[model samples]
Target: MELPKGLAGVVVDQTKVSSTKNAVLTYAGYPIKELKDAPFEEVVFLLWHTRLPSADELSEFRKRLVSEMVLPEKTVQLITRITYEPQHPMSILRTTVSLLGTTNDVKRDDPPRILAKLLTAIAAIIRIRDGQPIKHAQKGWGVVENFIYLFSGQRPTPERVAMFNTVMVLHADHEFNASTFTARVVASTQADYYSCLTAAVCALKGPLHGGANERVFKMLETIRDTGQDPVQYVKDQMASGHKIMGFGHRIYKNGDPRAVILREVARKIAHETDNDSYFVLQEQIKDYMFKATHLHPNVDYYTALIYHCFDLDKQTFTMMFAACRTAGWLAHIVEQQAEGCLIRPSSEYVGETNRHYPSR
Candidate 1:
């Protein structure tokens, strides 16, 4: 049999959490374009429940999630020790996530609490690495507000909160992407939530997956700092057989839907933060890439600028991705666990199968 490479176009199982069928991303049944501006907590509720929450339910859910945002004292102490190691932020994150599982009460932890702890833990990683004091989550603020304040140490304005909320929602889930698939495979083994998430983080640490956003920013900064012609820089990179990091996707050939929404957010935040020059260079490079290669930017493209505008370091970009994606990861873990199906697939053997080994 001629098998598909990397299981491309293969449907191994089903999901109710989210989908990218027909190249349009939807959570439950609601399209992402409509959900782009929805509250981050509301989108989380939808992903876990497969339906929109009632008003009272949403209010309570937000409170519950926010309430669980505090990390255990032992986890924080352990995170501080490992966070400043001379390794990539994603590597530190992988270790920290495993530590969370070890330090916390594994048996009693549920999805909401796990998700909360993951977010808070990610923020702590950022703070510790930066040598900044970790900020506490305030009681009256929503989840997004607390998250931003936790890492940034400043309360974001309403407009900024809305933009970051959209960023988180856009990244919350994509069905069967590499990291989510990794999480599902681990979950199928009846593993704990932290184990599943740690596996997902490892998969996402690859440059081709969640690490693309950081490379995108590095490329942008290189072009900007060197004052090179953006178009020529791209041509030179391509001529040398380099893959452009943020300009294409496997699923969306015409364009990434999330990129469409994020482009506006990137523009707005860039202008407000006086990073318009970076945004201008991005647009120039984007046009050249499309005219030259017929490739459109993916979600990582605009997010590079958006995170930069929020004063985030490029190295920590994938960790931010982990924070947003924990929701979908937890949701899928729950689903895969309930289904009780072990995700063990078979492989074909074609290497000299008829040959017999001689005694040696």
Candidate 2:
């Protein structure tokens, strides 16, 4: 395919980004194989900074991340208002982000302290809105640690905490996806960064974006209630011309590397949690998918089962994904700022061009 205008392949943005090779590469350019066995916390430091941190560096970073988890009082009130009632997670996230423009330092994006607060703001809003009592970072822990603690309401177990960290690291950045593109477009206009982020979040709310995972849960529920076997469910849905929620991808000709990584996590979590239902259902779907359409699982596919294994509510799956993805969003934003170009795109106008109004 011919590269479109705007350096369609020029790569002006140097943000922490990756490609799908069925091979993993983090924003920091670290190999995925090396990270696969490393602690998730370690990988996060790698992404935020170019090199791995020393033990002391890790300790200090943890302290900062933990402290950052505390949301502002006004933000708390905003989240409390929406999450208090039954609401869509993506709507709550995007709207709160738009409202966040009131508190951002868009013009002063260069200040380190100001930028830290912005990162904290996004993470805190998601946690606070989820009915999770937010926790500020401890004297020593950094942004990620504070998030894990606030999210789970207690100090996370070493292993589970690592899982959380790895997830954030893995999701830290992807190259110019829909939401990232939205954020970049808004930022190009010198508008509020939060406005860009809010636009991105709204884009993510679409079923084709982050919302598909929630739909997967609904699919499972429907199948269970209808007492249909997995094979039968796939057959009926396909016959009716329905696409499975968690299979196939535009980029992954072989498979999503993230899906493979997450699938292993799901297996470990499933075995540990002793939830037979998730894996049992997963197997059924996998079989049915292969038999019916040759479609295999994607990241969101296993994520639904994994969250259920974590005993998380179906409503908040997207928010959890958002939490991890916030890192990626920031990475892209900073990269766009470095490029310093307005992200204006031209449209082919087909309306009447030279027509003049009748002289009265």
Best by TM-score: 1
What C-alpha lDDT values do all the predictions have?
0.93, 0.66
> Best candidate, lDDT-wise?
1
All candidates' TM-scores? 0.98, 0.82
Q: Lowest-lDDT window of 10 residues in candidate 2?
A: 108-117
Model 1 is weakest, by summed lDDT over 10 consecutive residues, at 348-357
Candidate 2 lDDT over 37-100, as tens digits, reads: 5654455566556578999887766555554444457766776676645567667776766655
Report the error of model 1 at residue 7, Å.
1.7
Q: Measured by TM-score, how close is model 1 to the native structure?
A: 0.98
lDDT for 350 in candidate 2 is 62
Which residue pairs collide in model 1, if any? none
